[model samples]
Target: MKSDMSDTNNHGKEISDDAFATLIRNQFQLESLGERLQKIENETATMKDKWRRGDEAMRDFTVITITPTEFTLGTE
Candidate 1:
């Protein structure tokens, strides 16, 4: 009877340790996701600004395409 009671106590302790480890792992995963989202947002904003500048510059550019051989560029 004493040996059986010790076995039960060991099993309970193992189960409790496993639960704690699982909880920590879940928290780490959540933090990683938050960091990735922030990076994506920053990159998106930078790209948007670059696109706007390129569009503005193109509007001020002049087309001077030469026939089949060469070309020149000027701002108008």
Candidate 2:
């Protein structure tokens, strides 16, 4: 009877161990995903900064058109 009880307790412990392993695995996966997201966020900010600077530079550009009879200057 004592051996049977010990066997039962071991079975429960095995289930608990499996659950703990799964939890650890999930935590690692979540951490990896978080790191990837952070990298992407940084890259996006850099791209946004570049785009803003390019837009500002374009804002100062002027276009001129000259024909035989007319000349036109335009800012865009």
Best by lDDT: 2
Which segments of candidate 1 are over 4 A away from where they belong? 1-15, 62-76
RMSD of 1: 10.0
lDDT against the true structure, per candidate, is 0.66, 0.67
Per-residue alpha-carbon lDDT of model 1 for 6-76, expressed as tens digits?
34435534445555566568879999999999999999999999999998777656333344345435633
Q: How many residue pairs in model 2 have overlapping backbones?
A: 0
Runs of candidate 2 with Cα error greater than 4 angstroms are 1-15, 63-76
Span of ten consecutive residues with least summed lDDT in model 1: 1-10
Q: Could you give candidate 2's per-residue lDDT for residues 43-74 as a string of tens digits?
A: 99999999999887776552233453464457
Give candidates' CA RMSD values in order. Answer: 10.0, 9.5
